[model samples]
Target: MDGVSPKFVLPETFDGVKMEITGQLGMIWELVKGPVIVPLLQLAVYICLLMSLMLLCERVYMGIVIVLVKLFWKKPEKRYKFEPIHDDEELGSSNFPVVLVQIPMFNEREVYKLSIGAASGLSWPSDRLVIQVLDDSTDPTVKQMVEMECQRWASKGINITYQIRENRVGYKAGALKEGLKRSYVKHCEYVVIFDADFQPEPDFLRRSIPFLVHNPNIALVQARWRFVNSDECLLTRMQEMSLDYHFTVEQEVGSSTHAFFGFNGTAGIWRIAAINEAGGWKDRTTVEDMDLAVRASLRGWKFLYLGDLQVKSELPSTFRAFRFQQHRWSCGPANLFRKMVMEIIRNKKVRFWKKVYVIYSFFFLGSGQGAKGNTKGLKKFPRIFKLPDRLNTLELGFAAFLFVCGCYDYAHGKNNYFIYLFLQTMSFFISGLGWIGTYVPS
Candidate 1:
């Protein structure tokens, strides 16, 4: 081999040297097989068991709550009523109050126009609406696009302003803080924040503004977000279902139970005064929205969850983008736990059950049987362990019931529920592995 060319040969001076290329290759192969593989295989087994347990646990909890609510708690007989404004009323009277809509952008050139157009077309008095393009784009192309869009809106008599900062100090949070300091938004009554990917309906303000108007004590109103292109792929469809579960069931249930609910960052309106009173936005955690919501709620500020109003946003269509989003969410919760859990527990204003839910929500950070289950795949079958077979028959029955219900919800539209469930279970296994992938050194 050496006679062919020196270039193709190992250095002659290092001839006697024994290099552990195989060892390095073995390390690489260990990623595919070794302690990591062993645990992952074990995790797969435990995941099946834990999933069964979780199924049972959720069903029992939900059943108990339902029975208690029905037997003891009196259901509110309140009915929703819509009252449209009269033409005779002063345009300034009930028509339009000062509303500052803040659109936060970061490297979102692809959806910039759609977001801007949707915002500009909001059905509100032009004079009363102040749209601030809070652009923190490091890319010149994105910056130019934002400027041009702002100019176009200005020409059309829309009160839109473009803002750019030299450096992104606190990322999205910093952009918002700096924008708030600007005199333009100081006197604004309410501020609506939208991420670059969100395209709110024209009547979003018309629908949500009244809640703030009628309820003076309300600090924020969060509208449900719907994905516009959810049917684009299997990944997006699953995401849409997950989001539906969150907004429709979890958020509503939490709000109705007077438990802690969070601002989802975008598609929400905050009273400028309420934001100021809650100490404005802070950059201590990656989930600035959640941090602010919790701080404000603990500070005696009330939040309204507006179920009727909906804002449309794009879902991450690829597994890569979805994984990135989930990773950030997971890390944000971890960071929040580090920063605020103790303070939350110590707060006298938060209710006991709310504290429990907060604790439960933060349990995702624990290295428990659940985490292990989440990290494994079923492909390594036979090794897949059943969650403790010692669970009482009643517990197993309850688990089966809950599993069926969750499966029903997830497979509502599918013609073959079993296939759908299998695919979904596999996708989750893969995604969970992706989550664990974050901890691996590159």
Candidate 2:
């Protein structure tokens, strides 16, 4: 007992070591503490999670609906044969409807030749078909080349016109509207539009025009896009799969159910009357095509999506192009939704279910547009973390559940899981920032 009382240094050292460890752990917690508002940030995180869940549910529903349609629905009498339905007598007759093929271009030098060449090759009566090349190119070289190409096609016995404006007032949509103003177009019965990058098959008009001709109520017939550069890179491949899911599953379901889906800005044939009836093309919004489609649909016109009539187009080969495209997509829909939603609600023509779907579709359409690495509202997001970081066990568990779901999805062969993961991770940054920026303002 005397010896033990004489040496208690070990116990003191042990207590000192314990205090040091406690201090280090406190420092670690402080580091994770980050900015304050941990609770608010956690709430924001949960809200994001809820949005993600909604997104997932919508996708699942679309997939199921599309699959069921393909499996159980009767294959209608729709034809996909490349052989012209018109027999020899009808083919020879000059009574075919006047069709104007419009190629909207804006410095699209890379793919202009392919598109113009393809348009010239469209199998329609030589006199009845008018190829209008709307060249809004600012580049003198590109403009000259485009004009020369139009000349070359005209020399080949094709009725082609190269038109330019003093100024690109509305960019692409402006040029298209201006083309429609020409005296030549007034006689055209229908207008087939293709972006500069799209190359429709020779049967493009043959397959799509009949729908408009036979069904007077059909306003627009849109064809599915098949990416020409899908094999060029992993990004393109990812884009291809995503677009396929959209066209095959979502668009098909819309077609089967008569839902209100908009035109893809290209590869569509529009009735001249329908275009005029729907208030024509207005450049108030950047997504003039979708705006026109929605307006036309609201005016009791129907849209037909032909998944079989594939339009091969080049995907934007660079990330910068893809990003800008995405940004435009997100913003345009939001802008249109903002402008037209009240009209949609007040309109008597839209069915209740259709209205619901349209609202839901565009809300997410705008929301889903903002994603990873976009610097929009990048500053506002960090302020939510201004509170001390306090870990919420329940929320942490929910996050872990998401993690498991992602893992399960990857295991189940959605190799595009990487894309989903990247989007989800950046959703709070980009998506949340967008909503806050739009609604909350400065």
Candidate 3:
């Protein structure tokens, strides 16, 4: 006591003493994670369960649809051919109006060269083709690179114009709208939109232009997206199979049957008048492409899904990139549900079955949530083992039956039928994930 000499003492009610005590308690609570932890866990579990059920239902529905579609759908054997436009002189002589090719980009430096090269290589008359580079890049390097590319192409007398906005008002959709405001775009009778990543085949215009010329009411033509680097990795391979199934079978069948076919964002040509009448591209959702298509359909503007016309684009090479793309797509569908679903259902112009298909397709966006659910539910309820096991058994049985039938058809010298059946079976499951993954992100 003599050595301590009345050590300094602070009252519990003093500000410094109170603050020190409270800080220590806060640290202890932080380590413990407090009462909200249990509630957050509960909410998460509920979300997982709901998503799982939705995904399960979607997959089951897709499985059934694949079977029905295959059984009833028949490919049109008689090919409808269009006269080929062989040379620059022929293209120039053709009475078809000027076509505006708008290529929109945002930080796509890696793929920009290939895309621009593809555009320049398009088999269309240089005089009639107007190429608008809608670049929205804050990065000086990307801008400089694109500007130089544009200049190089311009020197070759490829009617190319480069434009960039001061700010991206609504991302891609805004950039496209701004591009349309240019006077050069106003002179065009049709517009062909391509993403920065796509490399369209040289004959794309030759093949697609004829369709618009033949059909007066046709608003847009969506060419199938084929992955140029599907075999790059496991993810890319899976994506390739998925796209093959989608473009080759599902979209073909859907369009042939006059069902609701969503407009793919790229590799498509649009009639300028139809787009104007349908109110151009709306930026209400991230997927301006689909939104525009649906609105155009609702307005009685027809769309053509050209199965034979292929536009190659790079699939996301990594899981993270793929996941981001999927998330954007999923959220877009949800947003579309709020924006267009009710109006579509109410519209007298759209057929009843088309509205139903729109609902079905919208549900397709929720499929990733289903994958998330399946992964979680399998972990949570071990009894759910029966679900996947049952599905596997059913899938195996179906495949086996098809194999036997295919062999029988081959023995009967119905070789085409046999091959068709085999391809159908293979594509059915391969493409089925599009619907399943909508509800399950994983």
Every candidate's CA RMSD: 13.3, 13.0, 15.5
lDDT of 1 by residue, 1-442 (tens): 5458875357753543445666677778877787678789889989878867875685466566655644664432232233544334544544667899999898887999988999999988887889999999989987998899999999999999999999999899999998999887766899999999899999898887876776677788888998888877676776788778677655665555666678989999998888887888888877888888878887777776766678989988754465456655655666777788788789897787777766565434221322333212222234233444222232233335545755776667454656555554554544533432223123
Candidate lDDT (C-alpha), each? 0.72, 0.78, 0.74
Predicted structure with the largest lDDT when compared to the true one: 2
What TM-score does candidate 2 reach? Answer: 0.75
Candidate 1 vs candidate 2, lDDT winner: 2
The sequence of per-residue lDDT tens digits that candidate 2 reaches over residues 243-273 is 8877988778887777888788999899999
Output the worst ten-in-a-row residue range by lDDT, candidate 2.
432-441
Q: Cα deviation in Å at residue 23, candidate 1?
A: 21
**Which candidate wins on TM-score?**
2
- Cα displacement (angstroms), candidate 2, residue 204, comes to 1.1
Query: Candidate 3 regions off by >4 Å?
Result: 1-94, 364-442
Order by lDDT, highest first:
2, 3, 1
Worst 10 residues of 1 by lDDT: 367-376
Please give the lDDT score at residue 338 for candidate 2.
Answer: 84
**Shift in Å, residue 113, candidate 2:** 1.1
Residue pairs with colliding backbones in model 2 are 35-385, 36-386, 36-387, 36-388, 37-386, 37-387
- Can you write out model 3's per-residue Cα lDDT over 1-442, one digit (the tens) per residue? 5665333444434768789989999988787665677678789999879866866775676666667755775433222334554554554555656899989999987989888989999887788798988999888999999999999999999999999999999899999888888876777988999999999988889888876776687777789888877767676776777677677655665666666677778888999888788898788897888888788888887766777678888988644356557657666777777877679879999889878777766545443532332122122222323443213333344556777888888888643789987885664344223332223223
TM-score of every candidate: 0.69, 0.75, 0.68
